[model samples]
Target: MSNRAAYETVLPYVREWVSYKVWQLRVPGVQVAVGYEGEVLFDEAWGYADVEAGRRLTTTDLFRIASHSKTFTATALLQLAERGALRLDDTVGTYVPALVDGGSPIADATLRELMEMGAGVLRDGHDGDHWSLLRPFPDEQELLALVLDRGQKVPAGSAFNYSNLGYALLGLVIAAVSGKPYNEYVRESITEPLGLRNTGPDWEPARADEFVVGYTGFHAARHRRRIDHVDTRAMAAATGFHGTASDLVRYFSQHVIGQGTLLTDHSKRLAQRKAWSATDDPAGRGYGAGFIVDRIGDREVRGHSGGFPGHITQSVFDPESGLVVSVLTSAASGPASLIATAIVRLLDAAADADAPGTPIPDGVDPATFTGRFANPWGVTDVARIGARLVEVDPSAPDPLDTPTRLEVVDADTLRMTAGNRFGSIDEDVTYDRAADGTVRSIRGGGGMTSEPWSVPEEAPETAAGLR
Candidate 1:
């Protein structure tokens, strides 16, 4: 199937899944934007931008995308390289002379090493309490001083150690090489040319009202207190970008293979090349310049995840399918990455066009398959929507948790089809019937069994309403 066709097949479940997540995780707000076949297929926002003020989140609402700023910074550096202004292998001392004069180890590290987080620079410098919101982010003077004094934590060209400080130094490199401030250069060159009106190097005072109010303490507790936004100043190139979900996906579209409007094909490849293995990653992700490269099934995806004081965000792009997904959430601990990846899995399942078993015969009552069942893991509800029988997890924060489709193979046996973070699923489901012809329990190939469950009398009004 074509990319658009694949997307359309899964579109119906997107909103329901997102809503379930917002309700399940108690996320204050969320924004998601999806691009397919060179065009945006979905751009939506959910919940509130400001829960206390009763402000609803919109597609245009700006979020502090934080570490995603590194991608733009990396792009700008590549742009300079393309123009012969600099080379990736050039040592930091070649551009910024202060580190060399101060005898900092990073001064000997090449620009490529810094960009790939293999320079082994300290993740943050001494007195990095700024991240705790106790003090403001560093200015150029403070950042330079920190680098000059603390130096590298590990030897250059060592294991991957994600360093905001490394990107911050790149911001300085951009200024030193381009003779323009990092933010000014990025805005004039990248955002302007791309017509990304909703994106900027940092939060703009004029657009402050459009920004979502980030929150803290929401991950572990229901009560979340608002946190104030701060300027990153010199660190803008590292973790200081603010943008809407739509603009983020659009920016990533430029990086798709054969798109080539921004950087040359060679430059794009160099930036996306796996420079180092992120061995610490349980998912086996790799670091590629500014992007995190990983595989979902057989397709390779490149993107970045961002975390600020109160906002968490993730974006991934599959060049083969021309699909990009971005998820932004207001809470500091939101599952932005998980949600984005799950959506990609759904699209992949649609493109594969492989559902389990044949459809139920016509004239068979769909209600026969409809009921709520429970297992040790959670509850699963089978319901008929239109002409299809779908299994959903009413208790899951992700509505997409249930099987995509359930097809009857016999009176008491069925096959469940669904997509997960890794890929597609096709498994048999068997139902145990009581003497009265009622489903006593349901079991899947995985050995998990779900017994009949009814909405409890004391269940929350909201829970009952979902039935």
Candidate 2:
């Protein structure tokens, strides 16, 4: 039972959402969990994780956390930090000697930089396309060799450009410093201590009956097998963990309540503190560490979002409410953050309705909210046609394409219409323009962190060298 049932009032709203008319025309299955003031307010699952198999996502249904797994990877590194095995400022080259490209000092890069996406590497896969093809796939050392020769064009610690390769390197570092396989270290360091039984890499096969089989290639025009592949051997630290909503409820409870076992309060602060940015997101908001921090209703909220080919996951922590809300979706089209916002609003409303109602705050000034601001994510070379719009020549949709579009939507919000190209309808998280009246930054709904900005300092050059 919650200290207060008022928070659970979000359930009806969520039920309405699950059964909404717009949803049917949209995505397929979704699983969501709400933890309020550190307690499980609602832990319910709806829709199907495996639609073809007719598997309904139960509150306990396990789904691939996708890149939400990075949150755990960050946690694992912090654990190593607490033990003094490595410092956040320690260079990558210092920890994982193999990451050095041709004796270059990748190790001199700080863990803090790598953890925060400031490390200037591309979002390349851990191994070559043939990574999964090799028998007894190459270990981290061999994986490093695959990209070691491919040196970076940008100097280390140049602005924030997220690279999956960086975390992959951190995974290797965690393994080296702990003297244990990354998976085993994570289990002992995080899952075991937190009592998160349902959480681990390989959601299925590990639990089989309890885990939802994630599907890939959703809505692909071409017919393709809906396959579930676990690159745990190669991607364990960066993208390997799995768990259920109930487990997360327990996980949230432990942390928000000062359980004090798994992570120290100081470490928790480091975990949540804002660090880096995506430079520019199709949305706004600056990136901070692994989390995206933004303002909502006179309060700052911290969170992150993740999507794999088949799964999309979102989790947010409301410091004001001591509430942590997480939603995991197995469908490619499912929108998890939308679900999270709806839940948050419902709870906030319920919180107010429970007590004597305070006057609703005056709406923010309509003036400060409008304008043309660009931070690299949407393409709106053409304006909206009537009520509906189309995306023409959006983001460097190709590997060589430079994504440079200043998305224009309603004031203080980003509502992008998905075309044949973009799969998700991203939300624009609005920020209060600095008193300076220039864009301090803006954040998008995808939870990709944006950062403090300088406009004439016009937008950061995301297209430079694209040619």
Estimate the overall C-alpha local distance difference test score of candidate 2. 0.57
Tens-digit per-residue lDDT, 297-323, candidate 1: 677999899999989999999765579
Q: What lDDT does candidate 2 reach at residue 445?
A: 34
Candidate 1: give the clashing pairs: none
- Give candidate 2's error at residue 314 in angstroms: 0.8
Number of clashing pairs per prediction, in order: 0, 27
Candidate models: Cα lDDT each = 0.81, 0.57
Estimate, for each residue in 1-467, the C-alpha lDDT of model 2 and write its tens digit: 24256554335444444434123323445667777655666677655555555555577677767666677778778877888888888888887766654575455678888788876665664444432334433356555764475535366777777666677777877888999877888888878887787788544464666766544333554222344545556666656667776666566554443544666767777776666544466334555555566654445677667665566777777644577778876645556766666556545544543332122124533234322234455322221211112222222222112212223444445444343334435544555466777655555435554544211211111111001
**Model 2 stretches astray by more than 4 angstroms:** 1-5, 21-26, 125-142, 203-206, 216-225, 253-260, 279-284, 353-467
Q: What is the TM-score of each candidate against the true structure?
A: 0.83, 0.68
